[model samples]
Target: MNEYIQRCEALIQELPHDAVRQNEPIYKHTYTQMGGLADLFITPTTYDDTQRVLKFAHRNNIPVTLLGNGSNVIVKDGGIRGITLCLKHLNNIEITDTQVVAQTGATIIGASREALAESLTGLEFACGIPGTVGGAFYMNAGAYGGQIADVLERVLVLTEEGDFLTLGKDEFEFDYRKSVFSKKQYIALEGTMTLEKGDVVQIKQKMDELTIARETKQPLEYPSCGSVFKRPPGMFAGKLIQESGLQGTRIGGAEVSKKHAGFIVNVDGSTASDYMNLVRHVQEKVNETFGVMLETEVITIGEDLKDPVND
Candidate 1:
């Protein structure tokens, strides 16, 4: 084996019990059902293990990337360059009084359910958000007219130097699908949320209503990355795409979802390139029709889409 591969294997062998993976398929890991292979995917069982991995990577100048549930990102066909640290093993949820403390890898839906079980409100809006706690906090994820900024108290993040720090809500600088962590290079470790005591029945009712609304409106049956674009202020991204008559637009395997204009789904034999082509086409058409540029919410990373090979 080459020196680099040998080093990675050594590290993997010594990795925490929670952090074990080799040649793992990245496609199965994402919501989009795309991507290639990860050289080494590590899921640290504890914060110390996570820190140790990061420290080692930093010391060795090894590249590292943070990945959550793969709800909002697209992995390159070439895969990641170095160690892909997955926070999935960090999943943990705790409730004390009106507070909810959870590790970064815990799903937002799970956290909301925990809140409901505890009769704590303020998280009903996130009942259906398909992302991890750390991802949601970093992006200030929102739905149904509420956002993470509304209830976030503080977040625990790891510095690039492997130090942990607690940042308060104000320090987060949350604004419309963005946070301080989003701009800065920091890894979320866990978060503490402040909620309110409310009638569980009412909270559950709201959650159910939103769930139904999402089910009725979104194309959930297909493999997709949720909304492909962010709301463009004063105009919904879906509405704009629908108005531009861009729905059902297809470029190879990927198509602008007929059910929801905001989604780009893998219809059949779709590739990452197909998705990218459709996204570009939608942007072009929307810009042509409305004089407004539609910004993508789905994070894409891959090589240039190769032209289709003829039969």
Candidate 2:
């Protein structure tokens, strides 16, 4: 057999599942329908498989990238090299009397619905949030005055060295938009959230109010990276952009949403470069007008199409 075939066989032996793909298109997974390809894409079927993949990649000195739900990330057009891990299949949510356990791949919105079904009260704020539980935990994602850190009790993670451990809320050091996961680059496996029993009617009412508020205030009709900028201290990012006359501005196919200045939406086919350019333009204009430089909440990854090495 040729060297390429032999190498493929060896890696497959280590991966031990059919959930692996070569040259996988990443745009299909993202909310904005952007991105190019991933050289090697893996959706592990179990926690054991995830550990195996991480350990194997580490042993072989292969670079590994993590993608969850793809709600707030922009992958450049040149695509990602090495192994890209997307744990979309290891999603399982279990609800108990006083808590809920969600595997990292499950959507936070789905988890909130499960909690509401059990008459739980703590997750009402997350009912309209996009992204997975892993993403939520990674960035301490929140909305409508509630954040994941408040309801989260602990988490299971695989360290960079391929060791598994559980960390409590305090260990996470949850801040405004970050956790230990963001600081230490830990791959979250699952999470446990402590909750309280509430009246189902009341829980649904709260969720409905938040959903309507989100749908009304945000541009949910288009594909976009939900919120592009962090809230400046004592100020709102959207309000600043709107006041600066940046709303409806377009860079290529990416446009600052006229409906909500906080969002950059893909009205047509948009590249990551286009999105980033628009982000920069909005920042420059807002800063020039009000001296408040907006900071990006969205994560950007992958390589540019113009990179010579990629050619």
Q: How accurate is candidate 2 locally (lDDT)?
A: 0.89
Top candidate by lDDT: 2
How do the residues 1-311 of candidate 2 rate in per-residue lDDT, one tens digit apiece? 33322344556677755778878899998998899888888889889888887787777777788999899999999788777889888789999897999999999999999999999999999998899999999999999889998889989999877889999988998988888998888999999999999999999999999999999989999999799999999999999999999999998999999999999999989988899899999999999999999999999889888767665
**What C-alpha lDDT values do all the predictions have?**
0.86, 0.89
**CA lDDT, candidate 2, residue 135:** 95
How well does each candidate superpose onto the true structure, as a TM-score?
0.94, 0.95
Best by TM-score: 2
Error of 1 at 135 (Å): 0.9
Indicate the worst ten consecutive residues by lDDT in candidate 1: 302-311
Query: Which ten residues in a row are the worst by lDDT in model 2?
Result: 1-10
lDDT of 1 at 255: 90
> lDDT tens digits, residues 87-201, model 1?
9988999999999999999999999999999999999999999999999998899998889998889989887777888899779988887889878768999999999999999
Model 1 per-residue lDDT at 246: 86
